[model samples]
Target: MLSPRAGAPPPSCPRAHSTYALAQLHAALAKSGLSTGSATPATAAAAARACARLGHLRAGRAVHGASAKLALLPASALLPNALLHMYASCPGDHYHLQLARLLFDTMPARDAASYNILLTALAVGGHVDEALELFEDMEDAGMAPNEVTVVAVLAACADVGDMDLGRKVHSYAKRQGYCGNVLVCNAAIDMYVKCGCVDAARAVFDGMGDRTTVVTRSSMICGHAMHGEGDKALELFAAMRRQGVRPNGVTFVGLLHACSHMGLVDEGRAFFESMEKDHGIAPAIEHYGCMVDLLSRAGRLHEALEFINGMPMEPNSIVWGALLGGARLHRNVEVGEEAIQRLAVLDPGNDGYYVVLSNIYADAGRWEDVARVRRGMKLRGVKKTRGWSTVSVDGTVHEFTAGDCAHPQATAICDTLDGLLDEARRRGYVPDTSVVLLDMDDAEKERVLARHSEKLAVAFGLMTTPPGTTLRVMKNLRVCRDCHAVMKLISEIAGREIVVRDRNRFHCFKNGVCSCRDYW
Candidate 1:
């Protein structure tokens, strides 16, 4: 809650003493006779800046308590702003924003810099709603926002996925001539992309002038690649290079992602090699994961395994997970065994990967191995996440979890789901019982799979939306194999395009084919 003031006073900055404050905090803290009473605002500000930069919360709080005891913050805007920033930059697990907000509320008078620092802290510190609330309060206090303010507010909007408000902020920036600011423009593009409107991001990117930098190129490329627009991402890369801008590691990460999504295995490898050879960028683990995923999804499991073994660094869980996923798809037991063995050593007791391995075993008719996996899970006390789906209708999201028939329309939704399942079975749609990993026949597993969250959500979608409407679903977990098989049939039977966005990526089921080509 912000209290309004008629106006705020000017900033009272202390003498700039420590330009090298961050690199020298340890030295200062190790000095003799640095008592709190004798400490000036400059010394405290520099120390707090060091603590904030280095993420030293306990030391920072020690300084904060001293400032409060010395009664220095109420007299100077600069000291209070430093404290506000210090608290805000404290780790989120510590809930630092609460203290930041307290400092903000008790400030004697807040200038634009005070508000700006607090705004940025809240936004980056995971207090998105509070940041927006403070922004509104700043405007209500008759303070016109500068570019910094708009960018911070826009980031908060993006974090909360408020595209409507983000657009309004963009409009305000344009009206204030702050849209031309390169950093602001980049934030706007990032905001749109994060809000699931790559088109809007493209609009912002195309509207930019000569101030675009490498960051701008990476953002645009990532936006296009994220939306399954591989060609567009590559085109942007070419344009970026044509303008004499060197691509960084992130640019190739996006490029590799685009190639992986589109199944351009050759191009993916080429871009990967080009990154190190031409761009002088060594591959990070994420880039290696992309290449592994690229090879695995294209049914090159042997080559993918070789690539993993030949890596310069030890493969992490993500890299092994890619191979495990490919093994699941191809039911190559040997590769799955190798990847799982490595993953078990690296990231032991990870339930998701273990489940995938169990599913692979069941698919290959290795019931003994599946039983061993179940025993391992029981020993490790790891349980699979219950799948959940969220369907938004009329601006309200209705959530349903597997085996949770708790909603008002649960009975009707289940009944409709039953009908759909019966029709699909009659049309030769077999259930993927391998995904269940239960000690039962396919028929028994089919009964269990019917109750997965996505089915109930699809049934609800059919009941609520009119005929021929595209049903969009967002699932909290990965879409299981049975649910995916059912979704493919539902799209054909219902004569509607169904889009299900899961944890990994989007699955657009149209005319019996998923956009991912069933790789995921």
Candidate 2:
């Protein structure tokens, strides 16, 4: 599939000098008029706006300082809003966010634009919880949110997979008539997709009908692809083409991702070749990585390795990661070793790669090698990433780590898990202890497996939800083989549809069968 080529660095903005000069003139005018204190808020606001537009943080700070010296900031909300906008507009460093927060909190009176500026900044800065809190405060203040506010809050909800908040914001958008706005609709689509509610995302996409953009279609396609609905993804692409909507690099990436997940090798190859020939889009590193993932996932390790060797550009960590994942899947120790060697150089401090290699060795029953890899990780000071899972019940989000007992409902969850495992065993469910990776007895391994983060989340779901309610859980790591097997058994035993979004993709279990068909 087509990938984005890294274009040359953008030419320096020629108007930067002009913009700075304009800001300087505004500052000079404001300072000259400061003697009489003739309401220089407008002048200072103009200077700040100019600097914000050009992303001149230093100049913006200077303007702020000059305005403060002239005592122009408290005259009106304009100058402070302009200063907040400048800090939010600047792209680098935490200093901008800190300063923005300080200014926002200290503002004598705030407006909707003021709240929107800091909310967008906090969300974009990855302070999602803080952003959501600010949004709540905005609501408490009787502020009617606009499209930007809705979009920003929806985005923050998506980052944390806060489906309850996301759904509320979606309703709010509809009530506020923001649903007609394309940007708002796109953000809604993205939030639903990321939250693993592909059906909800599709509903939004279909409603957008004539308003669909490349981003909207691409989001839906990738959503379907990631949910393992490859056929639907392809059908959507076909419809896109029929409707004369030109696909971009991201669309092809989703197409390739669909192919990779579904093992559609020939179709994937055709798409990859057509990316450059028909679409006139050069194959970027992401496209190459997708191709490698496709080939490697389909048990074509030799071909994948050959393809990597012949790449026009140097293969990156993602390219190697694809091969490594394939090798781990197919138990190709040699290929896995090779990929890890390259990965060691490319990303020495990453724990996931080392863990993957260690798992590969463990799968082959190479205990000494596994121990060696573990030692190497210790020497390099790389700690394995802790895995966790979150499940939302009745609008409350509950989090759990492996063997976690911190929740107030821990006793009930454990009891529920015990009962499920007992019933699962009666239904011919045998724990697959190979995934433990630790040198322990089968009994110990089984106990460890039973206490996995996903199991705890699933047990909690069982305890809290009504019968037949679909259990949706989000995990920070891939689900282990034993858990996958157990989930299928539990689905049949409890007559529940279980949906899990793991690090890799979504797994929907119903009637003792996973949507992935045990492939992932």
Candidate 3:
């Protein structure tokens, strides 16, 4: 227990009790070297607190070590908890979790506060499952979970997409009377959203007793956009505005993403402009990417190029990639080549730009230009990014490459894909072989495009998952245009939902329509 007078200061040292106490303690610690080890725990604790306030991880560790050596620490529970918090707030280091766990385990009798510190350490480190396991251990040890514990556990559940675990945690929070806490409620909303339980997320958002923060609103908007509910997302944005909660950068990102998904180009443009005028939030690179995607999807390639040119900051690889991609979509080979030139200047060693430029020339039937780009790539020593996809099934991530057939079940997987392709073709699916950049004959091009990693992943997903179950896949590269079209048809033929998160963003394919609305 902290003495009631601990936070107070002697009248003679009134300045020491002010908010600047941590700063003052830091200055005092500088005068007293660690080797001297002359400072008491109370003095060291003050210094650690100051370092934590300044976000100085190195200084805080030194003070913590000094305090342990001096034996000046009060054997009180609050002091240790405060010290543990100082360690937990440092940047992502495994040592922080190790130190926090040690402190929690060594405490004479663990309390809710001690568990809170350990739980937070696990959650921030992305050890979400471990955090939830500790939460159960905390309860089994007879410590009641507090608001902080609920928040941390919910965050963990969100990270792992464990909706069942999240709901159980939610029920526990309600039983413990911690559900009323605003922070816990906000985290619950976030967890629900991340778990793809959009309706549940909305319920949490609507049930909040207090005014929702910008982060909560942003999460809800993101959830709606991800689930392809653009109208609902816009409604929430409007409601947030009506409640006088000003949107921030994150909020605008969600709003813009919703507009992009629905192909609401006019609305997207207005929101992009309003980011600065209405919210005074400057557009970041991601925001610029969204604008370009919106313009390009709307068939305004020249306008998209103009937008890129007018940006106050230089565009990065993502911006250039989007420009090259848009020009290819519109068959504007000249514009695509210009974007590739800029991309080459910006990222001299990136092979993706070279590949994209070659594909553009191939689409335009300019074999000589394709050959020249290939030669330039060879001279510059840039290697193309290989297509790869990974699918998490039964908690195991399985990787596959283009045309890879090395898995134990390779025969079954390929046969299943062939069957799915036949079914898709019977339903009017045609393999778009134009996306293949090879300068070979039509038969070779068709064969190369059919073996793309995404298609293989989809084929594996179809064979493994139960019929009608949604299959989620992740890819390191953007989904090729042909792969995108094939997936749309595959979803209908297989009667399953497929969610793919590529290098750019999420694409949900269901009933032959992508979340990106053919714009991406």
Candidate 4:
């Protein structure tokens, strides 16, 4: 057992190159008695920070155990908070997150820094609602939030498209004099964009004035690209260049995405070629994925295949999935089969690739192949991911699944949807029953399509909000063809703007036309 001693110097934390470096640090600490009773609160805190930065979980836990045995908790709160921060900093580790939470709960005293660390961990770990709740508790307990708190909450808002809460937080940050804070401003910009409010994001970007960095510019370009405003994205990039702001790898990714979504084939190829030559940025996997998407979406499946085969690195799921997505869109059975063959090796359990391939076969009238795919999925126990959509009314987010009837206003929502569908049908809106992959009759298929998650969310929005209020719907998967058409009809018939953010991109429907212009 270690005995209490005076103090030891903090371990040196050079820029860690590998786990071997971390192991060396651990060994030095132990050899110098820094990991024993000689560890002071200051030394422990510094060591914890180093571990956090280097993502050395094992070393951090050892520090924690040593601190506990030395009765470090009673000496200073700083050490405990540092330990909490260390655990919270490790991403994709649920055990560390729980340890952080437990440390926070058991801490005798807490501060804003403590709260911020846990809040960030919760938001990044996909426990968004819990993060929001913790923020509320922090406010209730009079723990005034710092800039980090605002950023974490904004991240949660973006994740669920909680625009109402996001706006409230934005307003609070503005009043709290955080407007000049670049990090908070960037988070707000991202939140607005994710919530399908591109104008709001642009406003934030413009408000930054001279303070806008490469990150700010990149967010705006990506936002516009996501909203299918490819011209605006390209225009911004040109302006950025004129201003002498060199684009980074992220900026090129957004630019390439804009080109892909807008069907600018030659422009995309040029940007891909210029990335390394002009910008000195090597083509990363994401950039390669964007290029494949550009080619595939433009019905150049063969070219996309050749590009994938020639990739410097082995093609990952994203590259192959891009080709598969294009195959599904263009109904190229041959390319779809090729992509699936690759994806099966890379990610066989991904139900999405299987479903897409099945749909491609169904579209080609190859019923036997479709049946074979279904049988394989059943044998593999791979379940299709159910589609869902969420609409925020007031400050609450309401979620709906396909044929969902769980909401409190389910009856009224269904009645409203029926009326809207009837009106749309009268206005030349025919349900594309071919999108329904199930072996049901035409009428049944139409019924199924009518009750899609986005339609339900739209109906709920119409019933709950004022007539002119723009409805924002967030979907978990790609919007089907039938739902996309219905959105257009509803926007025109109801005389309201509808914004739907699906898995791929945003669709803004207004006056019987979509921003994507049927290209997406």
TM-score per candidate, chains pooled: 0.76, 0.93, 0.74, 0.88
Model 3, range 205-290, lDDT digits (tens) per residue?
88874567888888889878766778999999998888899888888778887887787999999999998887888999989988
> In model 1, how large is the Cα lDDT of residue 432?
74
The TM-score of candidate 2 is 0.93
Highest lDDT against the true fold, candidate:
4
Q: lDDT (CA) for every model shown?
A: 0.79, 0.86, 0.76, 0.88
lDDT of 4 by residue, 311-378 (tens): 99989999999999999999999999999999988998999999999999888878789989999999
Clashes (N, CA, C under 3 Å) per candidate: 0, 0, 0, 0
lDDT of 2 by residue, 1-520 (tens): 1111122211321234454455464554455343344537886687677666655666567677767887787887899999999888742347788999999998988988899899988888788989988988988998778898789889999888888889988998999899999999999998998887889999999999799999899988998998889899999999988999888999999999999999999999999999889888998999999999999999999999999999999999999999999998898999999999999999999898888888898999998999999999999999999999999998888999999999998998999999999999999999998898899898998899999999999999988899989888999888888899999999998999998999888998999998886765
Among these predictions, the greatest TM-score belongs to 2
Residue-level lDDT for 350 in candidate 3: 84
Lowest-sum lDDT 10-residue window in model 2: 1-10
**Per-residue alpha-carbon lDDT of model 1 for 17-97, expressed as tens digits?**
343643355554433113536666666776677666655555566777776777767777877787777776642533577
In candidate 1, which residue ranges exceed 4 Å CA deviation? 1-80, 91-95, 104-119, 126-177, 209-211, 391-398, 412-430, 441-444, 455-472, 485-499, 509-513
lDDT of 3 at 188: 93
After superposition on all C-alphas, the RMSD of every candidate to the true structure, in Å, is 7.4, 5.6, 6.8, 4.3
Model 3, position 105, has a per-residue lDDT of 70
Clashes of 2: 0
Total colliding residue pairs, candidate 4: 0
